[model samples]
Target: MNAPSPFSDMLFEKREEQAILTDLAYANGWMLDVDGCLVKTTKAGGAGGHAIGGAAKLLDWLRRNERKFVICTNASQRTVATYASHLRSIGLDIADHEMMTAATAAGETIARAHPGGRILVVGDEGMLEAIRSAGLEVTPPDASNADAVVVGAADTYSSANLNAACLSIADHGAPLYTSVSSPWFHGGVKRSIAVSSAIAQAIASVTGVQPIVCGKPSRELGESLRLRLSGGNSQIVIVGDAAPAEMRLARGMGAMGVLVLSGATQADELSGLPVDQQPHWVVQDIDELADQLQRVIP
Candidate 1:
């Protein structure tokens, strides 16, 4: 279980609308989640994804106001450049540098701790690219001298890679890193199982060692995101659909957590939770967020 957040008493409510308006107006940077908050894949197994309603316009407004932000995502099935092109095709004004992924976060975090370490990767092109780009050596699944094990939502997960991750962590104690623990992500217009979480869990089940998630609410991911912002975000608002990821991230950092109903989660699900487990605010989508910002900003 998560320790109670220091901001537990600071949770937002509709009656306290002024509090959020104040935060939004003064926030120096923003960290936005991509899978559900901003875009959704068209089908369960589609090539690319589509931007949410008014996502492009919302991003444009942020840029015009000179607000520092990054499109943080847990999905690393595709390269950042490839994902950027898909966003562009959907009319979003996103550049390659504006995006960050779980693979990227894990690579950066692992690199600083173990520079030039040998990493066993159970992922695809994007995950491989991230680790290699970080100056880490990518060893095959069955390598014995691996320094760490990094897992992503791989399209080619099999007995071979699964055996390698389990052995590396359970037997070698190499440590396990995963993208996100969320079980589902938006695919097209529906929710689909997130494979990486399943794979990580299987290894943990055998090893009795849980994997460290490196996306969304993870500080490892947050550090990577803050570095991307022009000046690190002193005040931030984390907007995303999933609570276990984005909401926990906000609580950990004392940032405003905004739950958008445009993704896997919905309004009906916000029944009740500890102050630390809930969002600071809730909106239907970025369109509503834009409306809220319009009311607050000069």
Candidate 2:
């Protein structure tokens, strides 16, 4: 009859973690994770594959609560507009600004840390583009002029690149910034080195300067999303594929979390985990998530 709070035992008990479905009834809207949760991975086609089980329904729900649905994703390679267009072509008409990426988070962090400094960016064009859009100059600077060494997913973080960044950091004392430390999932295949983790390790090894990570599980990402919520933490919901990142975000922000077993995490993986590490809601796929949200959110 009544909506369940995030603290309910039926959902988040000590060893058995179930999806906290009732929490959705009270939320303003939801923050849905894109990629594996919604769009099925394609080889190169624009939009030919079928939508993930709940993706279509989720899109419908978003259409109903246009202001409430925010698409937060870790895909750092593209701008929000590009992502919005992809969603649109797939029949999910979400606004550009509604989509937040790790690139944006990394860029925002760089802006806050150094207002107008020369950046030695070590990521894809998307990462560089986000930095430039944030009103900061994106150019290779002299060692002394280099303010910070920001790294993301770039195919060319070679030894020379690392040495250059290390020199800038060691000589000019530039702070290091990275997009995230998680594994890169491109079309469902995991990459060897996460750019964030690699650059961070390189910075440490060369200049002995630790990097500041900006994406996922980080307080910055959570706070950035929290600011856009309809209400305070109580009315916010975080839907994500990873446990460490999204669930940590939920606990840190005091928001509800929905973990879907579509991407990185598996069903067997949940059998033995502590309560604090568990999600409030666990579903087989995003389609089920859409049904639960529609039934509760109206």
Against the true structure, what is each candidate's TM-score?
0.87, 0.82
Candidate 2 clashing pairs? 19-281, 19-282, 20-280, 20-281, 54-287
In model 2, which runs have C-alpha deviations exceeding 4 angstroms? 1-20, 42-50, 141-144, 158-160, 184-193, 230-234, 274-276
TM-score of 2: 0.82
Model 2 lDDT per residue over 175-258, tens place: 888777765553232323455666667677767777777877787777677767755643788787667767777777788878
Model 2 residue 232 CA deviation in Å? 4.1
> In candidate 1, what are the lDDT values of residues 208-231, reduced to their tens digit?
989888876788876776676644
What is the C-alpha local distance difference test score of each model? 0.77, 0.70
Candidate 1 global TM-score: 0.87
Segments in model 1 whose C-alpha atoms lie over 4 Å from true places: 1-15, 42-47, 230-233
Top candidate by TM-score: 1
* Cα displacement (Å) at residue 221, model 1: 1.7
Q: What count of clashes does model 1 give?
A: 3
